[model samples]
Target: MRCVLIISKMQEMSNVLLIIQASLMGVSLTLFFALVLSSLQKTDTTKSYEIVRWLLAFAMLLFAVHYIMQMVFGFRAQGDDVGAVINILFYSPIAYILSYSILRIGCGNNYYRKFRIMSITGTVLISCTFVGGYLYYGSMHMKGALYIMGLLYFFSIVLFIIYPMKEIRRIRKMVDEESGQEPVLFNMYMRTCTKLLWISALCIAFSIFYTPLLVIIGPFFFIALVFYIVCFLALGYNIRQMSNIIVAETEDEVNADGVEAGTVAVKVVMSEERKEMTKALIEGWIKNQGYASSEINSTLLATRLNIPKRQLVQYLREVEGKTFRIWLSDLRLEEAKRLIIEHPEYSTETVAESCGFSRSLLQVKFKEATGFTTNEWRDNHARKS
Candidate 1:
């Protein structure tokens, strides 16, 4: 009876929840491993692709190492407090990656250097707390230290998640301002990774209770489930979604101008002469009334100018802190005024149509530009003429 009791006391595969949780973790590892390998096989040919690869590796490293430790130690880790310090260690870098790497996927150049500073500092603080907590909780058996450590770690994770979001909004603003290439797919997939990161953060927070088992049954393998979904989607992106994010830069070129609009830009990489060339092309395009087409956008205009759209966009932005659409509006407004002054007999619809402005749009834009309604401006100009 004593021997049987000893055997029964051992941590065994007796719990159905544990088995199912472990199986899900195994599935998570498989999918995550596949994601890492896919990132490797896809080649680091694009900035966005490379950033995605780094994010995958960051998550995989944490998940893989923690999972291995959990499997080997099982419930024993929980008993001995083996997981107290290391869980924070693993979480620190994963939070860093979640905070910065995914955001860098499209807007690497726009990434703030200060994000590096803040995340690194957060990592260091988490480390300090882990060390302090382990000594007090593990060495002194003061359980309060463990709670303090978990609380601090949870706050840090939340900070990391929220910090870079505003900059992401700026990225979309840049897109809407400078390029006609709608970032519809980029926004969607980006939202996907963001939601996953949030879920990962929450999972890590809850796992403070069972740190050693986090990668296994911790939080019921929620992180693993997230990984499964991401890898599944990532597989699709690797195959085709990559191109879908942000409309194709150009019809005839693979990221023509060596820039991905609203994402990868070649501003600093471009030379002065190259910039001047783009400027000249745009000035010539505008001089020829290319802005007179309501359907005209930066991408189409760049193609018509026979120059790279990215180059054209950068120039337009510098032309007065104006976006591509705004600049187009200004140009069209100018044309609308000229038509009114030169041909007063032309009706509002005629002038609006000639200048690529819908009649109502012309009225609105003209009012904004000259503080006068289109008809009002026309009457004033016609009276003076």
Candidate 2:
């Protein structure tokens, strides 16, 4: 009676395991579809995202295959050859996804290259174990292989933590300096990735526990399912947010182009008869109505030029590729430059004052515009002349 009870219990466990594996296989397929959709939404500028999407797709396919093999033949125990295949298939994608997303979220190609190497190395190692399990031990070496995989997964998690910490600090510093009003997509990515890292740490802890709970590891599988579903949904949300931001920015550019078209209309109407009149009007304004650096304003320029404020602003942007202040600053800096060179008797301070900027403001603006100190600019230009 004792032996019969043990055998019956083993059969029940087998059935339960098979059912769980089947359900997970379906989840993998569903996730694969979600990943494809996410990939499709990627902007043209995100070239690295394409590679990650494809890697995820391949990993999911491998997982599906591993599951089909199990359903067709059997997965009786942890030591089964099919078990190794399933374990590797299950872990590799999650590992690769974490690594790839870390790269996508923060670092550049050098970090990405390292992640790819680790991924490929993990794949090669798992592949060797799969072949070795099937050919040699039949199913016994699978647990040892999983412990090795756990080590690899731990390695990846460490890399994920170490590599992104610097970037996270950099972004935090940038956001703090810039007052945190960054684009929404960037902000969302930061929030999602920080959550992912914490969740990943938890997943690693679970994996370490999984090695000990070899027989009754049912809860871990459920936890893993929930974790992956959450991770992918978070990723999908970020992708959609980024795509929307890019599309919105693109539309803003298009609308700006339309505004430029109207500005051109004004130019064409004026071109017919007021060509010389417009020239004289501008020259007279520049000479007499001299826009003091402190007093220059879009409204003031529009009033003096008999143009609409919006039209003046648009015209300055379209023709000069600068806002009102930038164009005005360049004009002042040019005047300062000419005065300093042409009138050696005038001190740089006097020239700056004559050019419509306070002496201190002149130094600050000049350095900002030219990436050099006032004295450096004078010396450099003197050398050039």
Candidate 3:
């Protein structure tokens, strides 16, 4: 009698868990549509954003399908041959979608193309194995199909771990080569993606070994899905913020007097006079206008100079042996040091603002450029004066 009661209670709990999972899956699908709509509404969507949105949409669709399959076929009933086949069909694609999405975000276009080709080839090969195994061994040996699929799924997870590490290294290299500052939001997004992949892989592994365990730990899976949903929301928000920044910077460039001076046509062979004139114009713009603003970036500076951003970057690299970011930081840091030494009455905040740096950035750049904290540098300069 006690055993019967325990079994009944377990069954009740399992049903409740499935209901919660279904509800969360519905919420996730709704969020995916919201993201798609948001992306469509954006006036300046980049190729990268488009790819990310499609990948996310496909992933969510797969999840919704999987949820419907569970509800219709009943969870973890090995006796149902059709349900098992449906699981095999839909389950593998989720990993592939996620893996490809991460690869696209983390890698360059050429690298992404190469990895995607490899992924498709692997998928084809796995599908062949599933079909051949099912035909030859029949339903009695469907375990073989499951085993092969599990191995492929595990391989995808390995990629999820490896590629993100490579991506992190690439981002770090970019920071070192161009700017000395990390892109905080981008890094956070990458980390969240990596974490979600890990959790998904673990859940898949658990489900493979002990299907009943999913019923017991279903709430944990739902929690991970919630995290996944939050991560996408954060990504969308970040994309919007980046777009707004670009728009505002462009407007500022347009509003500046003599904006046409910066829009010089790219020339294959610049005459000596034109070269000198262009150089003078760029210098005057930076000194007169750029140095007074804290929100300047390569794009904004290029627009103000009337040159392509790439041309400006190339020119800085060729002539100054510095990236635009480095060159700009040097200009700001030099002015900041001057303010610190010459105007002792100016507060740190005042100096930072005058030098076109935010207070936090001012502290970081001050230490990096001078090998002393802002306060230490100020105190040392005061003593020397």
Candidate 4:
């Protein structure tokens, strides 16, 4: 009977250990994933915005490493000491700094220095309280330390929440001014992150109830890690959706074969009639004008065709898959080559002039368009004949 009781007790202990180990493993995995996604989010266009997010991810990674080491090494913080110290040192400062950067970016570039100083002051003040709490109540029970840490964290998290919201709103306003329309996806993603920040902050405050475990290893950290991972995935989805929409629009414009009224007519691949009309128009214009230098310019071509600028651009891109200037230069240079080879009596300068280019311009454009100088092109053609 005594042996059986001892075996049962040992089994119970083993089970408990297994549960704790599993939880720690889960948290570590979550932390690593958060770090990767957060790194991607660091690509914000503004340097100030990118820096704050980078610091937040860096601090969180450090906190994760500390937790993993403690879990594996059989370490426990006496009372709620660990939670208080980490909350002050890593959590509060990261939150405050990130918030301040958002606010500064929203307000304007000019306000960044002032907000940075304010964020630093907040970090210092909070760090002092955290250190003081630990030093003064080092020997106190877990409950006493928990109460002190909880109060300090509440204030810090509030500051963090308020600043980011104000800054995000400011960003929205600026975006609205520039684009002259509210960007739905951009605002939605920012709002989602801000909302997550609020929820994660609340989770931290709630985790104070589990102060003993929190001091050993906090659920707040794990929860924050998960929240950030979700935020990044959500943001990535929105960006991809926007990208897809832009690509679809471009493809649709290309597939439209005919001139969408007020545009230079586009040649349809299957419609020989429209293709013939387009070729005739281009040829007739070239033949009558005696090859002026202005024919190579897209803006000049669009004006001569009585077409809208955007339509002309789309027509050239879709039908030829080349820009107006490139297509025009190829045609002009090819004609110049034929003239040089067939009419040997024509001088190189005269051939260049007749093709609507100065002697130097002809040589440069010819070499750039084809991989050869005019003289080289002449020799290659003569050798072929």
Superposed on all Cα atoms, the candidates' RMSDs to the truth, in angstroms, are 11.3, 17.1, 8.9, 17.5
What's the residue-level lDDT of 125 in candidate 3?
A: 65
Q: Across residues 1-385, which tens digit of lDDT does each residue of candidate 1 receive?
A: 9988866754353344346446645765765677667666666356665665657565755666665665665532354344545566676676676566555654444464667777787678767766776675565243666566567677777767665676567556655664333234445765765766577667757765653445444544455446534643454454333332234322234324355455565456556787688778778877887766766666667778887766776676664467787877777888888888888889999988887777877887778788999778877877876
Q: All candidates' TM-scores?
A: 0.55, 0.48, 0.67, 0.44
Q: How much is the lDDT of residue 147 in candidate 4?
A: 59
- Tens-digit lDDT track of model 4 for 1-385: 9999988976665455445545755665565566567557545344544454455556556556655654554233332355344544556665664465445434434434544665676667666665566577674334454555566667667766676576556444433322211145554555565576577666665554444444334444555445554554444344322221121123244336354444576453434564455556567777875355522444445566665545555555666776655566666777887798888677778887777777777888778877898888878878988
> Which residues of candidate 3, in runs, are more than 4 Å off?
1-17, 40-43, 79-88, 180-182, 215-225, 240-334, 345-350, 353-356, 367-380
User: Comparing 3 and 4 by TM-score, which wins?
Assistant: 3
Tens digits of per-residue lDDT, candidate 3, 264-361, equal 55445444665676688688986684675765666666677887766676667667778767887888888888887788788889988887777888
lDDT of each: 0.62, 0.57, 0.64, 0.55
lDDT of 2 by residue, 266-348 (tens): 34333424445444655687787374444445555566778665555555555667666666667788887777778756776
lDDT of 1: 0.62
Error of 4 at 145 (Å): 6.6
RMSD of 2: 17.1
Q: Point out the worst 10-residue segment of candidate 1 by lDDT.
A: 242-251
Candidate 1 off by > 4 Å: 1-17, 75-86, 110-112, 136-142, 210-323, 326-385
lDDT of 2 at 29: 83
Model 3 local distance difference test score = 0.64
